[model samples]
Target: MDDTQTMHAMGIDDAYHVEQVLARGPRGVTELVTIDGVGPFVRKKIPTVLAQRGVWSALGGSTCPRLPRVEATYELPDCVAVVLDYIPGLTLEQAVAERGRLQQNEAVSLAQQICEAVQELHRLGILHRDLTPANIIVADDGAHIIDLGIARPFTNTANRNRDTTALGTYGFASPEQYGFAPTDVRSDIFSLGRILGFMLTGIYPDDASYATLLADDPNITPRLRAVVERASAFEPSARYQSVQQFAQALTAPSDPVDPVVPAPVSMLGASNGGIRTRAIIIAAIAGIVIVALVAAMTLIPRWVANGDAEGTAANGTSQNAGPQPNTSPDDNDDDMVPSPDSSTQDSEDDDATRGDAAYDNPLELVETGWSADESGLVHYAFGLRNTSDSVCIQFPSVEITGRSEDGSVLFSHTQALMVAFPGETTYFGSQAGNSNGTVPATVDFTILEPEDYNYVNSGESASFKVDNLNAAPDGYGGEIFSGDIFVTKDSERVREQSSQLNVSLVLRDDAGAIIYGYTTFVDWPPEGGSRPFSMDVFDPPAYDSFEVYAQPW
Candidate 1:
């Protein structure tokens, strides 16, 4: 591969024969090139800004199954030329024109593939701001996402208030991509929603008849239609938070009660489990009268004491905010984002400690931010580092409060968090698209400590390790670390539940100072077997080295 990487040293015209001119526009010219010894590849000449060079360099090193691999990249004064493996297939746009719109199951299948691809891009910190049928190719291997001409990395700075560039393809770009709000992982999700709708309605989102056509289509399931509606909501926060979530929704069980709810369970996401409303409904109906009386008795005095507590509804911000680390001089200069925690579970006041370490409110807020847009949309995200040496505890949920000028709790929501193992950082909070847009005068985060939990001892310290670890470029000039987790415990001795591991990436500089972090849930290794995993960090402060934190999920 190093020998092939040197191909970029030669000029494009000198290295391969230009077989055909495929596209020409502001994204630059696209041509099919054929090498005598090699095969056909798509070469794109993309005009670059100071900000785009890093993205091009990263793309040159990125690798994903559903995305076309970049063979080489050449940078010029004005544009960067990228050579991508060419796959023969029709674009989804053309596929729809030839065959009629897809059925529910067909669209769902393809949508899942696209979601998987987009989720990977987001994981690499690249947002495919433009997602439409035309950018997807239907090939033998399945759907391949093409065209990163308009792709951009997630902003690595704290000043990312909005997508400064208001350029996105019409009909599919999220409102945030139009500079309404800052574009993040959710922006791509909005576009995928538009693509899903196009698959069923055969009409672009910008079309006047598109909405009615999609809603009135008898073939499209009401359940599927709801997915499209939520995905394309004008508010960025209203959309599925991540593609993994969107994909889960596409294949959700038809029965409302049985649906695998798209809850934000981790950095990458988890698929199983949901709230059983039947029991809740029965309990609610039976206790309404008593509950109302209880509420009246408990609320009146508390409401008086906590002036803005419930009244924060009018002064509150949005519900779910995407992750954007707010770094300050005193904080570690690392670019990170928050990820969701676990699903519903019971909590008890059981003080759990690990191997001589006592829990003393171990959470340290390393990064924080709160912002709102003119559209009344609000977003807030913060990174938390567990300072304890070996203590790992449950932060089942996080309470973020929006306070009034006098520092009174206006309103707050129980935000999710990625399980942060000892000495690692995880993000908390989500974007709320339909927020009141009121920027809180003061924001407070309260980590609700779990009541009871399990604690592992030091004897199992060497329970797992990465094998054949490999590091590659993540396209935005960052690095991707991948390896297989080999469990040291004997397969016969370990229970299946004990193999569920939560892994987090820790990137540090040459001097070993922390820079970036991310946490994800790994698939259970087969009864103490091994499973592969990768960590994508976009534009970390330094890429000198990395560390992986693995513990029971």
Candidate 2:
């Protein structure tokens, strides 16, 4: 393996017949090199002492299955070159970005695997000081931990609380790595939690775009969200003590346990103990009530059968004429009749309650604008607001009809937005198609409800105002429009629900004739914050003017 093969087949210092350059760093270079017997392998050159120690420990000692295998290492004049097994797969970061947010179950399973690997490393007295998403690779076999460049021995001694260097990625790194505390197992646990957040939100922990953590992300479940929040707590003492513990809690059953109900006395055994005593007491009380009722029944009829002191019967008739008795309470019905005023008031209250329960058209089109690029494509963007306090409506589909100057239909396009939310103003942008004329004369917008759309019951209401709206044309015949949605929080508590925003934009001619119509959208906006939005249209050169509208159904 040490024999000189070629000088320059692929480039830099052709000593090892390099197939391709994988990566290059300030201190070292990674390349795909071939051997006579071994088909292909990834070779990394470590020009620094710290990295060399990591490669040496991995090659000679670490037994963690998740860690990459170091096949061989050779000392260079000023560096050490290590040959490693090249696992074929995208990095975990790449996987998350490509797949968007992973399902909760999938993220949990993946986190468990990572925990197992890191736990093994800690058991072997190694601390992977830099454990970021880029250091993990997802392949057919399983997730593999890579890039142990900063790994070092972790001693449990009291004096191990201090370190000379502050090393690790922001957001993923623990406070200890910020020179605030000691770097230890707990530090890795913090990074793992951040990684879990990334997998569940498709957003890195430190990115400004993910300012709220998982607050607005609908893909994450509340149970998982709580787990992440606790694990990523700023204080190390507040986090899970170890990787194993964190994994256990992550995979633990989240649903609350149901309380046990007491068995009925009838189902108890005939032991003649407490059960027998309770039964006898209940029977005695029932017997006394029965005797009293019987005594009253025996006396009531006799009293009624006899005439009163005035010689009047119980039926309010003269006893001398006839001993008439009332047979039922309905004999005097006038006192039971309802008053007109009270009845009318009750009816009005019912009508008001029904009206409150009814669903209103909560979708509102705030505004619309257009832009065009040099390529002749026209872009349209619009704003929409959800007016209903409780209902979180989503637009499953939409239809737009473009008409000519004479009001005759020219073209139409149907699009699925899959957008939803309540109270926040959502911005939607889309490109219009090439037009036969400058623009369609008039346009119509239609919104379709999603299959699983349901209105939720909420006590609070949300309101938003669109401002700072502007539009411009791009060089590619596309338009760019931007605006800020200022949301004011409701005075009452708001119920959290998920929904998407769907929108339609129409270009109209001066004659009020149909011109062009299209659909577009942006997903749910934050609950109560100012969100700036921009839209681009690609299909170009249509109507003289445009109108924008939004709807959630």
Off by over 4 Å in 2: 1-15, 52-55, 209-213, 216-218, 254-553
Q: Estimate each model's TM-score.
A: 0.45, 0.43
Cα-based lDDT for every prediction: 0.55, 0.51
Clashes of each: 14, 37
Candidate 2 lDDT over 477-497, as tens digits, reads: 345555665555432222121
- Per-residue lDDT over 1-553 for candidate 1, one digit per residue giving the tens place of the 0 to 100 score: 2555445445555768888988654335689988886778998876554236655566655677888888877765545678889989999989998887788788888998888788778777788777878789999888989977678777763544344344455457765543223678887888899899999987766455677888875788788998998888755555777787788778776422333344321211112221123322222222111111111111111101111322211122322222333221223333221112222222321222222222235555665444333332234445666554554533234455667578865455554332444556654323222223344565555555433232221121224676777787644334567888877644321222232454555544344433334444455466556888865433223235656755543
On a 0 to 1 TM-score scale, where does candidate 1 land against the true structure? Answer: 0.45
